[model samples]
Target: MERWKKRNWGWKFADHLSELYVVALLLGVAGASFAAALPLASRWYPPQYQGLAMGIAGAGNSGTVLTTLFANRIAQHYGDWHIVFGLALIPVLVTFILFSILAKDSLNQPAPQKFIHYMNVLKQRDAWLFCIFYSVTFGGFVGMSSYLTIFFNAQYGLDPVRAADFTTICVIAGSFFRPVGGWLADKFGGIRMLIMLYSVVAIMMALLSSLPSLTIATSLLFVAMMSLGMGNGSVFQLVPQRFQKEIGVVTGIVGAAGGLGGYFLPKILGNIKLATGSFTFGFLILSGIAILCMLLITIVQRQWRRTWIGASGKARAEHV
Candidate 1:
């Protein structure tokens, strides 16, 4: 009887969302799951493994690759976008069942803090800094993921299928490299890794602003997305170290800022294109933000080493 009910809900849930606005609402709700993931990962893993644990979980963003690669083709083939939503229920149901069976709660869960405590957390400078850093890194990664297909279609005259293929290749790099970023941060230091990653993004975005050839543009975007993905991992690596007890609230705030950044980036680019007849200013502005973040990190690392993580940005032995 329980199994039958689950199947019935799944079928109706996917089949009934006929409106695009409803789909967008559902997607927003689903995306909020990312905020829950890192805190759970931090609770389950030791400080030394925080980055890797969060990165592995965060790599779920790669689900975007599946959508980019298949959704359009599926819609075109069926001549109806609604069927794509219905087919999506298969993976959603599978994940739900697997999580229900396999997931475990960590024993070291922290006591819940009061509302005032959370509000005070917002007063801390570090929390805002993390929010800003994530806004740029995760923001750039998702923004580009959402917009690249359109950019390719408009700029290079590629058909929807070909443009989506290009976007998938870029998204794949960002999605998979997230874990690598965390591993590197664990081995070296999150701060150091992010510094290098931001430099890469700054350079790549600047080059891309030139409106290079199709091959050159794709190569640049691939590199930029990889850096942004890694930067996302690196930022989270530092967050738990700096605010272990407040991980849940802090992660939610930072994650929301990243989402806002993602929302604005495409709008900025689109508006720039309309106003100036080119994407040059938008890319240049993004590049400038990267440079600013790099400089900010360099200045802050000195104080950070003294106050929290060691000189190398690794979690202190006692903290771990």
Candidate 2:
């Protein structure tokens, strides 16, 4: 009996390790796609349309909504989470085939920068600024997407299915608004739009810290997500305009920062909940960060307008 138990434990441990390895590979591919796609989007579109184009491509993150909505249900139906992973490959394969057949490089590809030129992007202040901005916007969007279902279940006593439903609603809002945010940024200014959106995020997150009624909390999350999504679009709108020559490297850096931020936000929330018996401090800390981002953008915009983006923060047509 003891020998049988030891063998069972070994099998379970091996299964867990295999799962971790596969998840790591999946994330690696996803990260590379994100980093590579933005640069292509920027190059394919003109400066004036950069925000809209990138926003549309970035909106692909809405795929998370489908997973959040269905993964648990699918797993439960099959009585196996592994089956869910297997099913996910269908869309991935379809996307790969479609992209291979349809995708095209820009006609006027920029000359490849040297390794030193790519490294020099890290020395630029603007690159770091973009990283921080995306850390809050894209970071918050992804972090919340991962955590909201758990939040709903713990705080509101919702069933797993219902919690996932609520999370799906919020993810949909964020995903849908991304393109709208870019279009608005193009018409107004990325800086101006981000300032307003960050302010909204601060306010909504602050309200969430109070642990309001379920309806109100979900509404606020939906609104906050919209702002975060738009903020993502707004940030990228400015990226290509400022670092046209180094978009690939800059996007990779900024995208990594966003991923790190996403990773940490959930850790912060989970740790805060464990320590405080609530997520209030976590929400408050996020709110404070949003406010800080708002102020930083405000202070920086004066100089940004004076330099690259001009008075409106719009990319000048001549730059294209």
Candidate 3:
């Protein structure tokens, strides 16, 4: 359907509504693919190295940088930017074939979970904790990626191209640090790493809310993005541990919450801008939420240390 929409002959039938509907369908598939991949990584890797594995998988986000940087150039060069979409289909098809042929289920896979199992999983307090943590971390990263360019243009008076360049820098920093964050979580601990990451994010957001000078603000954003990226890695490091038996469903639910957080962030920024005539309030509110998440993490860290982390000492020793 998407391929047809991109073809010249089918362009006549591909109105705006049809294009949007196709996009919605594509996004659904993309979300499901991400949710599935999380559990696969957890299953394939040992407990201690799960964070590193998940971090590598999550780093696929770097594709955002490639598309943002090149999509426009491809469109301008081709005289029909939608041609890029058509070209993208080739890679998608190739990857699909490659994945189908090469991917294998883990030998130690758990029994397939039922829908009721997922409902019961959702009832667990830790599931909701992980969801909120991911919602803020992944949510903040994606939300900033979506809005940073606009913020630069509107707040700092940067031209569109320069704004995009700045955004790219922040995104690259964030994407590249994800695996490092995971490795650190493996060495240090996911919860401890996240507490620090959240504190840094909260501080950076607070500074950004003050609308500092361009250089300072850009630096803050870059640091915040990097921290948020790490926070994302750190959260996933703990997810598989907390929901070892139900990682798949918990991943899907937490991932969905993260997406919802991303969606709400832009709305919050836009609404706050309209209501109070600046983005300061929105940033402050987000900062507050980060702090709140930190407090929640602090509250739960004790039980987690006793139950999960303490029990996993043998696994960590094996990795060593």
Candidate 4:
């Protein structure tokens, strides 16, 4: 690592473009990873046994806050983080130098991708089908992460630190549940898992809203997070299976939709709590959305099965 940077340290100005893309991907991974965990780090916690559990979860999610707050000052003195950053730059800087130092931009015209091809992909109803269903899971994971701390503090009557701790528990369950969700989907079909998880989430949220006890509410919301995380994995798995030909475009579009849903869930919760002095209505609305997603996925799954079955029947007839 030290030897490589020393060898390529004198990179020129034309080298910045390729290196910049590496830096951008670095920032994307950092932002997405941190966004996945931030709100959990900012909430409050319960007492005794609950506190201990929340503390462990909070510590994992709190990496983002810890890095943001302390890494700079520590690095300013010790320089460990910078050493890693310098190491990351080695490939980016070297590649740009080797390519640009000798090669010219080719004169041959590059073929353009057709807008109609992307439009044709967009027109496929199955594409929108996954978008709707996955939005619940993706939205729930990202949204709940954003509002989990605030929602717990407000709904469950914990102070900021305690709320953060409970939210951390939710975050922990959701993050870990992602892998478990994928495993479950693999064993049982993804569509089946999505239906199961979304149903559980809707039911849990409704139950959470009505619970007067903080302990009960916290427990139910934790369950909701688990379901939401599983639903996210299920939705993506379904997306790839259903839209195998256009997985990349469908993934990007559906992923963005899910993120958009996450962005809105918190704001709506805040408004509902403020306007009505109750979270029951808010929970009920989200439950409705989840139910709708479940229904949509179920319908899509049926249609897909029928289409495949019909095609197989025609093939068998031809053979006979």
Model 3 segments more than 4 A misplaced: 1-18, 76-81, 311-320
Where in model 2 is the C-alpha error above 4 Å?
A: 1-14, 17-22
Task: Please provide TM-scores, in order, for all candidate models, with all chains considered together.
Answer: 0.93, 0.93, 0.90, 0.63
Candidate 4 lDDT, tens digit per residue, 32-146?
A: 4322222222122111121122223323332333333343444455644544455445655785597568644323212435666655777878777766775677677767776
Global Cα lDDT for candidate 4: 0.59
Sort order, TM-score high to low? 2, 1, 3, 4
Q: Rate the local accuracy (lDDT) of all candidates.
A: 0.89, 0.89, 0.81, 0.59
Better of 3 and 4 by TM-score: 3
Report how far off residue 23 is in candidate 3 (Å). Answer: 0.8
lDDT of 2 by residue, 1-320 (tens): 87546653311322467656766666666767898888887898888898999999899999989989999898788777767767777898899999899888788778887799799988889999999999999999999999999999999999988999999999999999999999988888899899999999999999999999999999999999999999999999999999888888888999999988888888899999999999899899999999999999999998888789955578876675
Summing lDDT over every window of 10 consecutive residues in candidate 4, give the lowest-scoring window: 309-318
- Tens-digit lDDT track for model 3 on 1-320? 98765665422333467775876576667767888888877898888887788899888787768665666667677777557677767867898999999888788779987789778987788888888988898888888888888898899898766777888888887888888888888878887888899999999999999999889988999999999988888888888877888888888999888888877888789889989989899899989998998898888777776776743222345333
Candidate 1 overall lDDT versus native: 0.89
**TM-score winner, 1 or 3:** 1
Clashes of 3: 0
* Candidate 1 collision pairs: none
How would you order the candidates by lDDT, starting with the best? 2, 1, 3, 4
TM accuracy, model 4? 0.63
